[model samples]
Target: MTTPTSCAYCQQRATQLCAGCRSVVYCSREHQKEHWKRGHKRECKCYEVTSNELLGRHLRATRDIRMGEQIMCEAPLVVGPKVAATPLCLGCHRNLLAPQKPAMTFYKCSSCSWPMCSKECEKSPFHLDECRLMAASNFQSKINYNPADPEGKESAYCVIMLLRCMQLKRSNPEAFARLAALEDHLKERIETPLYQVLRANLITFIKTVLGQRDWPELEILRIAAILDTNAFEVRQNGERRKVRAIFPGGAMIAHDCVPNLRHRFDDNMRIIFLAKRPIPKGAILSISYTQPLRSTVQRRVHLKQVKCFDCACERCSDPTELGTFAGAHLCGKCKVGKVISQNPLENAANWHCQLCNVKKSAREVLTQDARLQQEIESLDKTTPVHLEEFIQGHRIDLHDTNTHILQAKYALTQLYGTAPGYAMDELSEESLKRKVDLCEELLQISNLFDGGWSIFRGNLLIDLEEALVAQALRLQLASECESKLKRAEELLEEIKNIMKHEPEEMQQMLAERQQILNAAMAPFSVGVE
Candidate 1:
């Protein structure tokens, strides 16, 4: 017999509640709906559910979150041990630590006296703009100084946000001012959320709880929030959606081996999430927030050490989970067999099939993949000009849709139109058509993987339309060239629609393509039958 709790909004006995924020509760579905409508929307986390010590804790919804909706927009809480940072506290951005040894020395914050690990870190380009402001502030607490520590290690989430803000400040002052004024506490901490949180909590804890104004624990938490927020999400260009590394707030979403959501970033650095599959109500929505290519043991180890969670997600619990997706290969002996896991976590495996018996270790497959990747990386930048052989070599080891292979194909597509090498002007008509076919094939895959209004798809369409026009012109048939030109116009219209938001860049490309199209049509437009 458990006691019923009251809702934070309407004061009714609540059974269903949020698990993250724990600031609100709900009596029933109807009450929850009514309360949500009345203005509990922004701070409501009713959908999130997690257990603390096995007891369900309900958190309030922070905003009226739709399915696959973004609930909060946060800034990074800290900056960096920048490859180029002047002696600023990566935690507070104060000129605290100083360089201990100039040659053996990494730059340390003059104020905090904390030294970074490397000179490159001391010279991070991202840290340059902020160094001046940090230096000018006299490294003292002003009315604008809100010094609050974050919940854990410096939040990479906050640090990255601050860096973006600082960059914005340099490029667009009005926008920067607007962001700075968004929260009063932020302004005091030089518009840093990590500092505001730390200041508020540290002040209260010291005055009310411990009767002290400062604590080392507070500083540690501030640093943690900074690290959590500032970490970068590095990814390749054509990945349908930008994939960012999980930051602090994002990292808190928890893990499920069978995740419900997938996320990608835009060029502008906004995080977007999609429903990988339909999720029912009361379901705990989750995203992997990590590299899906890693093994269970590797993933769990990284998550535990870096994120402080023991992931018992379904993928982690099963030995063969994710099907050892990252490390699978064909069997050489059987020729028709696939390698599989005997124990995925332990990296022990055997390759066999229903018809034959064969075996291989995880190490052998991983080493092979690594070797292939290294070789692929070693190719000269101009290799795309010789796309046929490049693609053929990749096919030997990498799957058609593997990220690296897809990237290579994208480069090949661009080269078909732009490459000025021997392969370009010397291309045979049949060879040119083959290149067009390859572009079409790759575009179809791009649509499947990253089709949500992507510029890559638009560019591919533009290139294909141009190739078709060229093919028609070469035939020296007026009527046929005109028809192909019409098709090119249609393709351009489609590109315009997708690129409406990027009018300048799209217009420039459109203008260039139109000139080429006009030249192709000039011979057809003259007086003729």
Candidate 2:
């Protein structure tokens, strides 16, 4: 990569190439501005794509990155449904509005039978290529609104994304090149059951049914694999809608269990990454590929299955799981000691108890853990009764910070203030104490695993502050209430900083919380003024 010596507009010794089109060289800032105004706006990408030994290809620092800095902002290269169970607009990816009468039907694309929100979306450039292909194939979609099991109505629109990626080869070859460049882990995925199903069904459809057999079978499969390896799942703060999109740059940043970065989406659906903690120059930038609350074992298994690697980060290698002990179980034989994995990184490692020297097979531990998780999933989270019952049942087997119990506690935090029988004011003193305890416990855990102004810690703080404020109102002592309120204020300030990169909805929530705190304090002040 030699630097260009001539300007793109006029032949002169170049000082800068057009950042958007690195191909175009400019000798002066004035020439750069002229080129940008003329046409470079069409291709002004913020980040450069590069390759390395560790990540294959990953986004890297061009300069020193500060704390709370915005690194990459990217729009979706291709967006479509994600394993949808019901009819949703192929354009907007929202659940199709069920008809008022049983005889009525969902809105459909005028060109293709696939669902669409309106005629405008039907005409949208994003949907047109696939729409034309499906319409030409005479493959009418049977997926429609099923009010009986609205969210469970299985759809055949899964192929739409694959088709969109295939269409890009014709529509934009450059983007197709980028998509093709992504690491697909095809060697690993080929043995998986999903690839087998695709081989039998998708291959026939793309080659025979759609009559596009000219495309190489491996290339088609490679595109599908690239999507699986690189795409992001995107949704708004409160929306039920979820769609898949690829941000080439965002896709390149590698994963760390305790990541330095956190990501959020704007209303337009662009992915934005912000530094959760101050990242030093030359340090690898990463984000968590798994949920923050998941135990090391669970995260490792998921990463192995999906990303095709075992995570051996600081959190995963530790037997105590960074002191959270989220994967630890009670030693059934010892009756007093706790059990943990002998090798946290290995799937087949034996479990051992510190006391009594009791040992258990990995199979035995995993099976029991699975059974407990299934039991927890069967319960209704909106009510605490079932969760509490499950907790009580597992009292002997699970420690307080065991993944299952911690999951129950997290669910309880959401249910306490908002559940029908347990609104904030209606909560008994004992229940309020429990909610406070859960939030505090998780906050400490967050410090260990999701530290330094991460969303996980910020959310826990929010829950804890609310619980403290509610408790303060019931306390007779003025000093106690004031002291608790002051802590809540401090937490609120931290929340503001943690959520600076968030969408407008979070800002609104913060404002509402501040008002709530202010109103709560008005009763305490009996000023002379």
Q: How close is every model to the real structure, measured as TM-score?
A: 0.48, 0.88
Compose the digit string of candidate 2's lDDT tens values, residues 170-231.
89999988787778888889878998888788888888988887988888888878888888
**Each candidate structure's count of clashing pairs:** 85, 1
Which pairs in model 2 have colliding backbones? Answer: 85-153
Prediction 1 TM-score vs. true: 0.48
lDDT of 2: 0.81
User: Model 1 over residues 108-151: C-alpha lDDT tens digits?
Assistant: 54432234434444455545455444455443211111224211
Alpha-carbon runs more than 4 Å astray in model 1:
1-328, 336-348, 351-355, 385-407, 420-431, 454-507, 510-529
When summed lDDT is taken over every stretch of 10 residues in candidate 1, the lowest stretch is 142-151
lDDT of each: 0.50, 0.81
